[model samples]
Target: MSKIDLRKNIVQYMLERKQLAHISARVGIVLDITGSMQGLYKNGTVQEVVERILAVASKFDDNGALDVWVYDHEFSRLPAVTEQDFNSYVTTQILKNKNIHKFGRNNEPLVMEDVIKKYTVEEQSSLPAFIIFINDGGAVKSTKKVIVESAIQPIFWQFVGIGNSDFEVLKKLDSMEGRIVDNANFIHLEDISAVSDEMLYDQLLNEFPMWIQAATEKRIIR
Candidate 1:
């Protein structure tokens, strides 16, 4: 199916079922660009991921653009993508960008700080921020503190693990204490390429509506 139909059929149907049809928010996607991810990038799996994610963005974001970021030890905050430019986004924008610090070690806190800064400081908005954070394990301990501090803000982090790695920090997002409200969720998909779009969308969106409800009640999204 084309992207428009994918948005109108699968994602929108699920959003309506989950009662999120009228919700409005900013959408963004962050990718892990460590050495281990080269295979996924080379095989075009990353581009497919972008297309699937852009369909979700089309529904939730007013302008139908998905804000983009790829991070390793350092990061590169790329341009936002819409349906028009989402084709081959990973190859054209990320892989070819000489300035992007790619294939380094994973430093979750460094990128996490910049992500919070983008929503809370740079382009401050009242709308809640939904962030899709994809990684292949190696989640450092420093990310816990950042996630805890971000709990008070209007951002929800959805962490998706794509490969078989010991995702210690991401696995504990829910039970992490001292948060004003639960602000993040983690799901591991051993091979994202193997998952059907319907299932992938379901998994990606599972807890976001719940977060919207909780963040609303806590006045974190007002």
Candidate 2:
């Protein structure tokens, strides 16, 4: 089926199941778009990895709000301030000039900082917000520790490793057994960047169901 149709069907299915309410999650996606991501991999190109991520994020059909933000160091500066600016960076800056940035190499610090700033001081009395960080490597600055420490409590952080970068850092941070992080835990992935388009699609298709399971457990969806 078409992407739109698939998304609509998924949403409709959840609604019919009375579980749509449980799917309400404010998901914030922090994507790294540095130049090094363009490196050749055994499975596919770096661009392919990015496309896969976008596809996964876009295909998410839950009722919870979705915010996708991408960061790259080519524009100079550690973090790009303002969502409007960050959005513009993806559509205008990065889309127009794709040669300068690598994926996770140089953009981690900026992206992390930007993400933290986006929801750091917000007063959340209801549901906890979900933040997913997908990068290929490490951070440039020591911003993660400070941001993680200062950010208001009760935030769920997820890290997805894309390339040859060290995923051990993610393991150290994750407290949960599964990918679901409850109340200030980290969830991460190893290098799944080398998969082909078909493989990537299958992987994502398998993973999407977990989002529903987590949302249900959290009572975000029915």
TM-score of each: 0.97, 0.53
Q: lDDT tens string, model 2, 20-112?
A: 333334456666666555443222443333344433334342332345566666332223222123233344434555553444446455555
Q: Give the alpha-carbon lDDT of every model.
A: 0.89, 0.46
Model 2 TM-score, 2 decimals: 0.53
Query: Which candidate should be chosen as best, given TM-score against the real structure?
Result: 1
lDDT of 1 at 147: 95
What is the lDDT for 180 in model 2?
31
Which sections of candidate 1 miss by over 4 Å? none
Q: Which residue window of length 10 is worst by lDDT in model 2?
A: 75-84
User: Candidate 1's error at 76, in angstroms?
Assistant: 0.8
For residue 51, give model 1's deviation from the true position in Å.
0.9
Best by lDDT: 1
